[model samples]
Target: MMTEQRVELAVTKSELGARLQTSESQVAELKRENEAQAVDLSAMEDRSNSTELQLQEHKTVMEELKSTVEGLKGHIAERPKVAFSAALTDAGSVGPFNTDITLIYTKVITNIGNHYSPATGIFTAPMRGVYYFTFICHNYGANIRFGSLLYKNGERIVSMTDWQTSTDHDDNGSNAAVLQLEVGIRSTCVSHLTARSMMTVIITAPSAASCSSPCEQKTLQHLQRLPALPHVSRRPCSTFSGFLLFPM
Candidate 1:
């Protein structure tokens, strides 16, 4: 009987030991699985951060492109028109005198903000481009001499001195000057005359042929339709008549 009891005790001890080993193995497997989950979580966090950074970069680039497009649109909208006109004189003078006469003068005349003139009859530009200008003077037949066509901002592109003589019924002579301009400049067409008589000043556009329609459409119609002409005092020395045309 003692031997049988001892055998049973040993068997029970062995079974308990086996059960403990199995439990320990299961706990180890669970710990390993938890460790794998942690690694996967860390990798997912890194991927999310990288994707966010890429998205922000793309947004910034898009905004920059939008701003660039807007700037270009504004520049194109502000491009200049081809024709314009202005009046430079305010009074009339009677015949029979010789002196230096300034016919047309103005300060606020310009085709674009890029181009402007002082009130003293000068035209200037802020940048470089092809510019056309003209000045006309009416004088009596002593001798009409066209002086300097000064380009104030840049070198003169073109000029003419003794083109031809002007004829009128009252022995008056007319002179016209055409000039080509460059960027960042102004110009003045001056005339020196020997004899004295009644005069009117007219300045035409760059190419009276090409710009005529636009000039007439945009400028001349508006100017001619002004409610009334300004009153002018008569002078005895020389009559000054001023007319501006952007003829079509």
Candidate 2:
């Protein structure tokens, strides 16, 4: 009986030791899991802080861009607007003057900046800039030379002439120029006709029917005195127009 009791006590002690060893192993695994979770939480916190910093920087840049855009808008609004268009007249015809005469464009079609004068038939530049100018002339006569000249500050810049000797009594001519004008510069169109005496004149008359480019001019030295000079039409067909292309 004593031997059996010893064996049972020894076996019970061995069983208790095995159970304690398993419990210790489980505690160690639990500790390792907790440490891994702590490291993951720290990394997540760093990422979140980085994201917030980037967002703040982006917001500041957007605010600066908005301010710059508003300033540009104000600058554009303050720029001057310049454009003009005018016609000679509604009357039948304008000129056969013995000397050069500035054609008055009394009919104002569009005068945006009011730089063109219907009173003086001149366009005064309001600011230094590049401008585009165009003019049209219509003549009504047979065997008569007629045209207009664009003058800048009293000097001729360009001229357009149309002479017709055929049965067609109507002729049309137009010219355009792009010019860099300074402030206070004046531009005008004039009847390009010059006559020294009633019997003769230096004009842009075609010597022959097939006069080539830069056609030759003839002197009307002994030609019969013209009863009435060819008339430049005062209708809207004869017009002067200009606009600001870009500001310097």
Candidate 3:
């Protein structure tokens, strides 16, 4: 009876030891799972922080771009629109004057800023800016030559001369210049006349009294000969055009 009791006690002790080993193994496995979960959570937090930083950076860039665009729009809106185009006459001939004469482009086609005056044959700059000017001279029939001089504040800037040849009856000459002008500076086109006197001196407004000494009576007589051209044709015989390229 004693031996049987001893064997049973031994079996009970072995079972308890195995149960302890199993419990320890489960505890180690749980610890490893908890460590892995903690690592995953840390990685997720890092990614979220990185995404938030990138979003902030993109938002800041967008704001700066928007501000720049708005500023450019405002600048464009404030810039003044300055441009003008005019024609010398619809009538056939203007020259054969005794002396040089300022050619008045009386027929205004487009005068956006109204800086060019038809009354005086002059363009007055409204502001300090870089300006572009162009002129066209046309002559047809006979042994006629057309010459024009562009002047800025009484100083010559450019000149154009066209002559009708035996083969070519019609002739056209053009000149263009980019000029830096000051506020209130005057620009004019003057016709250089020869002995024949067929081209310029064709002033009707403010009279011929404003002309040089030799031109008054001759201009008046010519005015009497030629009638006023109220209606002009589609194509212009001569043209003077200018525009403000940019403000200084």
Q: Score residue 186 of candidate 3 by CA lDDT.
A: 69
* Residue 172 local lDDT, model 3: 60
Instruction: List TM-score per model, in order.
Output: 0.34, 0.69, 0.68
* Least accurate 10 contiguous residues by lDDT in model 1: 212-221
Model 2: pairs clashing at backbone N, Cα or C within 3 Å: none
lDDT of 1 by residue, 37-121 (tens): 8898888889889889989999998999999989989876665444334433334322222333333333223444423343544
Candidate order by decreasing TM-score: 2, 3, 1
Better of 1 and 3 by TM-score: 3
lDDT of 1 at 217: 7
Compared with the true structure, model 2 gives a TM-score of 0.69
Local error of candidate 1 at 248, Å?
28
Candidate 1 segments whose C-alpha is farther than 4 A from its true place: 1-71, 78-84, 94-104, 107-111, 138-167, 170-183, 194-248
Better of 1 and 2 by TM-score: 2
Instruction: Estimate, for each residue in 145-223, the C-alpha lDDT of model 2 and write its tens digit.
Output: 5555554434445666655575756666676777777777666655434442211111111220100011111211113
Query: Sort by lDDT, best first: what order?
Result: 3, 2, 1
